[model samples]
Target: MLLAVTRQHEVAANWDAASLLADGSVSPEAGCRELPGCWGLAQPGPGPGDRGPCYAVPAAVGPQLPDGCKAPRLVCQLHFTSWPDFGVPFTPIGMLKFLKKVRTLNPAHAGPIVVHCSAGVGRTGTFIVIDAMMDMVHAEQKVDVFDFVSRIRNQRPQMVQTDMQYTFIYQALLEYYLYGDTELDVSSLEKHLQALHGPTAHFDKIGLEEEFRKLTNVRIMKENMRTGNLPANMKKARVIQIIPYDFNRVILSMKRGQEYTDYINASFIDGYRQKDYFIATQGPLAHTVEDFWRMVWEWKCHTIVMLTEVQEREQDKCYQYWPTEGSVTHGEITIEIKSDTLSEAISIRDFLVTFNQPLARPEEQTRVVRQFHFHGWPEIGIPAEGKGMIDLIAAVQKQQQQTGNHPITVHCSAGAGRTGTFIALSNILERVKAEGLLDVFQAVKSLRLQRPHMVQTL
Candidate 1:
């Protein structure tokens, strides 16, 4: 059997390691289960799948060897799963990771590494340069990017397609030289966290504080074309620090009367298995409560996870936007609280949120939104309600499944610190259950891409 491993866009270390057969049959635990078009036929494995590109490991590609042939010829192919169909990856860390894995598994004298994409020019050439340059950097401790690209283009005119891809080659090298290898195995995660929490000298070279400081790069790298920062949208934000990253921010195009007015201080944070899984936003301000309801209506959100109370520290962190009784209207949207379950740590409220606009689609008329509000958070102290938090997450996930597959709305005072913790908790919990791996750092980093300053503590 041939060897292969698959990973998604994010750093999904929890995915099962699969052994691929000649006929594209994967181990029973393979993560993806979809019938892709380019795959020709729907096989149980991840191969010839064009709909969602995946990776193939170093294998001897050819007909079955003679009865007991020794030292068979080896042919290796590794597709860049993290690379986009259009552009290079957002960061070189993931690409560097893929390269490290390939080098480690590849047996000595494995012929050569062959990389290809659709056109076999842009990403293809870029990947070749990265792999080649890293070798030079390790042996000679020097790099000539322009010289290398020019040297490569001599044989193939299409090598190193765009300036961005060219720049990415350098970014990948720099990341490698600076951070050696940051990808941790799932088994070593707990030990790694314990080390990060202490002030030991082992972590002194690159401490937890330094790792947290990398959020600055994560923000600048994912450049924002922001409407949240605009004058018209600024007032809608309840917190000055919570500007939604425009890359995945939700748009409000279905407004009834307002034209050219689609703006909300909300960003789409990806979940363990889904993109745009959670809408991370600031608690609704007094004037923007209507806008908040509009977001719920537009996204057809099924769950709202409120991590903070309306009034905290004698301040109105969130405006009173829900009713305890029958129903209430907030501009173009109305909310009716059907049931309110109270507990020492969690207060569950079921809401029937509706848009007053006239539309043919009945599904858009109203949606059942289960709000999971936790009262365990202290204004200035750390939370100690571990069991309650897990229970709340269980209830929320149950509600998400009972309802349809819709994005979950999560918010706090600024939607970064507390909100991020809950989302990461849910994400990490779900990943641990499904993949048998735990990587809290990767989960936190994913949140920062959608909105800045997510999961600020260890």
Candidate 2:
């Protein structure tokens, strides 16, 4: 059996490793049931030229043999570390030699070979195709790689997952054809490959490509677009969208009046250390201005982060939701201007919201909320530079900490673009501050799970 070993995403390493340990038999010990039986049979066997850390499992523990057959089945597991997940080997000659070693170990092709990579479709398929094609070449003097790959895929989908991998099959066959078993220098081929597939000194481009592949899975993404459980009015009132099967949509309660509007285009988005610490929503639509204020009052939000300008390119992006002059009354809530300060690249407006109706607690009538409008932030792109955005996020966090613990309202034109970016940046930045390290890929993936299409662009 061919065992492919490579670095895996840390979060999925345990699960992926578990799948690799099982042989064809069921063991009596619960913990060792799934482990490769070879581990318990004998000491790790010596490999050919340090190419593999191979192991041999005795025939006694092999899957139950035929009732009357006394013959034994010997299993040799060859573990090669040359290949990596989602990546082609630097040179195919080394792997070609390894495959030849595998064939030499089991000359008669005794048992059904179990070859696998992380997903069991990428590197595994590449090794199988090359090995099978080389056999055909020795007997027939020619091979059709495409037909072989197509036939293999008919049985198992997504075999030889990338063009680079497919191309490697041809390269290996060509090398084997030109210089049979004789060793040939591969430095030139490695140079050409580096030119074709970028430098691999730091991050693995192949791994990133694999990640992008999983991110673009149409089936799972379409499943996230379902909205049957959402209220009809909420669906109609949405400025952005609700991910399907997601129940995190913010629901604002109305105690007095539902005549004006009952729904506001808003959703509760979580932060690094807190749940529902930030609310992502669209800029206040003219008709929903009062509803927006009611949300701020009901949720006891302390800050409103306005990412876009009030107007952009003659388009009224956001209505003057808060009081522009002395004071403004939106339905039952009266907002009085307390202070306005423009610092650096942001304009900060503080307001005291008081309720007209009598409340259960006398001290709960008035609530203070701050609106920080960041000027020069474009409608369709990220901030000019990261520093301004970072500073703004820091300021928001500082104010939230000083003020009573409350959710912050963050919004842009559509609420899913710039707003999501800001929230993701803040959450990741905070996580880095606390944890001393961060995984941008995992961070973004988690954010999208919470609010679909959040941080929409890479």
Best model per TM-score: 1
TM-score of 1: 0.78
Each candidate's number of clashing pairs is: 0, 2
lDDT of 2: 0.65
Among all candidates shown, the one with the greatest lDDT: 1
Tell me how candidate 1 scores on lDDT: 0.70
lDDT of 1 by residue, 1-458 (tens): 22222233222223332432233222334333323442332123434421111243423334445686654343444555555434467766557656765686678756555554433455667777888888898889998888888888898876776777888899888877765665556688878877776774555645677666654566533347456667777767776666877777888875558753688888888776666789988888888788788888778898899989888889888887899799999987889999999877889898988777785377767877888899988888668758877888898889888887699999987888988998988887876665455555556766776688887665
Model 2's TM-score against the true structure: 0.52
All candidates: CA RMSD (Å): 8.4, 15.5
lDDT on C-alpha atoms for all candidate structures: 0.70, 0.65
| Candidate 1 residue 96 C-alpha distance from true site, Å | 3.2
